[model samples]
Target chain A: MEFLSYLISGISLGSVYAIIALGYTMVYGIAKMLNFAHGDVIMIGGYISFCAMSYLNFPGWLALILAMVVCTALGVVIEGLAYRPLREATSLAVLITAIGVSYFLQNSALLIWGATPKVFSPIVEGTQNIGGLSVSNISLLTMAACIVIMVVLTLFTSKTKMGKAMRACSEDKGAAQLMGINVNRTISTTFAIGSALAAVAGVLMCSAYPTLMPTTGSMPGIKAFTAAVFGGIGSIPGAFLGGILLGIIEALAKAYLSTQLSNSIVFAVLIIVLLVRPAGLLGKYVPEKV
Target chain B: MLKVNDINVYYGSIHAIKGVSFEVHQGEVVTLIGANGAGKSTILQTVSGLLRSKTGSVEFLGENLGNVAPHKIVAKGLAHVPEGRRVFLQMTVEENLEMGAFTRPGSEVDSGIADVYKRFPRLEERRRQIAGTLSGGEQQMLAMGRALMSKPQLLMLDEPSMGLAPLLVEQIFEIIKELHKAGTTILLVEQNAQMALSVADRGYVLETGKIVTTGTGAELLNDDAVKKAYLGA
Candidate 1:
């Protein structure tokens, strides 16, 4: 029973990581740029929802929508302002710029929201007894949200025109352009979707933990990024798989081994997995075709 | 029909194309034969809106293409098969075709893909297979088929025969001939001067970013200087 409880909470934690990982994977897949500022966007989302629900007396759903809107716009603006100009630059240069953007977001959040932490109210309160096991409603909701998001994202990319356009842009930007698909618009749409997902992740994460701060997104952000790489950086389904596995491993390690060594164990496992599959579990190792 | 008027293109500080002017008449096959770095690809890129000319204009269907975005140029009836067979390697053959018709209306895409499949049955056979696994000749065919999915009136092929075997090259040239018979106006850029000339109705010799000479395909094919420099005579 205790093990089951740990697994449930692990899955809940993994769900949040999956949500955050989707943003990283999508942007990396389409724009071929790592938006390290993505984690900071989660922080912004938390702050947005916090201000909305607490100060403005907005409902949970309304706060969620507001955060999504702001984050979506923020994503588009960031892509346009920071990453767009560096499209032709080297990957290392873009990665450095991404780090710069990350720092900018973190510092800006500090200036705006201050360094102090806010006690976050659980968006969904109380617990539910399902099949003789009691679980927090927020945890169940997080898991549900993750599954629904995964299905919706899969359908969106496979069935819709814009989704297919995004896939094409990821596959070959120049060829996609020649096919008369608007590559820039597709990338911008990717950013919007990714950041929107980030907002959902932010809300869920803060709700589960009930502590919100400007730096709250950083650690989870890094873990989710690791999950994305574990599953395959460019594959959506990969992110989900990676996140769940990472969360489970971290949970199990903390429970069975030593709590203080959990993060170290996680990183160590990652190194082993990567050594076996360099492209991650789902990523295709494409030859240098160019 | 397309008209390129005094187009001067630059690659940053380097003047890659200098005062290049040419035209592709309706249903005509025009070949631009040149050595490497002679700006053959640059001219095609300029016409397709990939690279903006430093000076001069490119008019397709009697309208200037200067302000048009690269992605929008195909909708204007000019499709460029860029240098290297840049098929979406990760995508399946059908998916690549689907992306090709991205600019077209949803209603027309099915028929467009059907028409392409009819033209290239090999693509139909490998519809579900990833493009990267395709043979070099097949990838070139897929690239051409992808370009054709845009319903282009003017097809600009850049190095379609590049890196293919001699037999595969002949097969590609045969397809080019077939496309010409089907009334697609072609602007073919090639390093394979001999094959380019044989299929071309007219040919232009590009040297160091300028058109050094121009003539009928047969005339250039038989010219003493062309024979000595390009034909290995």
Candidate 2:
């Protein structure tokens, strides 16, 4: 029963990582540049949701929707203002820009929201006794919501028009351009969708845990990024699997070993995975064109 | 018909295409033959809107293509089969073909794929295979097939015979002939001068990004200067 609780808790944590991983995967696949600011966007979403709920006095569901919209718009703006001009520049230039954007967002959040952690209203506040296991409704709901969104996202990418465009852009941007796909629009749309998913994750995360601060995104973002690389940065299914697997391992380690050792375990797994399968479990090797 | 009026293209400070100019009439196959770095690919890229000319005008069907986006150039009825056979590695052969017709309406897409299959029966046989796993010759066929799926009025092929075996080269050239006979206008760029000229209606010689000579296919094929520089006589 204790193990079951740990498993459930791990799954809930994994859901957050998967949501955040999408942002990292999509941008890296298209632009081949890691958007370090992605996690901050997740933080931004939570803050936006918090503001709507507290200051605007909006309903919980309305705040969720608004947070997604606002976060998506911010994602588009970030791409336009920071990424578009540097499209032709070196990868190093873009990497620095991404880091700069991240720092700027984090510090700005500190100025506006303060250094102290803020309280967020819980999405669910009760616990359920299932087969002698004490499980919070918040955890159950978070896991369920993650599963539902993952399915929708999979379908959206595999079966929809825009999804096809996004995949094409990732495959060969130059060829995709010849096919009459507006590469810029496709890339922008990718950012919007990835960030929107992160926003939903942020709200759910805040509701489940209820404590937030400016630096909150840094840890989650790094973990999610590790998940992205572990699963293959360009493979969606890989990201999901990697996230869940990482979360489960982390939970088990934390429960069995010292808390200090728990942090090292994640990186240890990453190093092992990298050694075993450098392309990642689901990643396909793309040879550089001659 | 297409008209390239004294276009100038640059890569940073390096002048790639210096005052290059040419025209391709409807229902004609035109070949541009040049050595490596002769701006052969650059001219095609400029015309297809992949790269903007530093200074020049590219008018296709009376519409100015200068400064237009790459995809918009495809909508304008120009399909470029790039130098390398850049088939989508992760996508299946059929999916790669589907992406080729992304801009076309759904109703037209099916027929487009069918037409491509009809032209390249090998693609139909390997429809479910991932494009990247194909051999170089097969990938070249798939690249051409994918481009044809777009149903372009004008098809521009860049070095279609680049890495093919001699036999495969002959086969690709035959396909080019078939496309021309089927009334698809073509602008072919190639270092394989003999095969390109044999298939083209007219030929242009590009030397250091400038069109040094232009004539009917046979005229250039038989010209003393062309024979000396390109034909290895």
Q: lDDT of all the models against the reference? A: 0.91, 0.88
Docking class of 1: medium
| Structure candidate 2, residue pairs in collision | none
For residues A1-290, write the lDDT of model 2, one tens digit per residue: 78888888888788788778867887888767899999898899899999999999999889989999998999999999999999889999999999999999999999999999999997557899988988888788777876776677778777777787788888889988988999899889889988898788888889877888997777888899998899888888878877777788788888877678886998899889999999877787855332
- Shift in Å, residue B171, candidate 1: 2.0
* Per-candidate iRMSD: 1.9, 2.2
What TM-score, to 2 decimal places, does chain A of model 2 have?
A: 0.95
**lDDT minimum window of 10 residues, candidate 2 chain A:** A281-290
TM-score of chain B of each: 0.98, 0.98
lDDT of 2 by residue, B1-233 (tens): 99999999999899999999899999999999989999999999999988888777999999998868889888878899998978887778888888888878889878988898998899999999888778888889988988887889999999999988999999999999999999999999999999999999999999998899999999999999999999999
Model 2 regions lying over 4 Å from their true place: A286-290
Per-residue lDDT of model 1, residues B65-84, tens digit only: 99999988899888889889
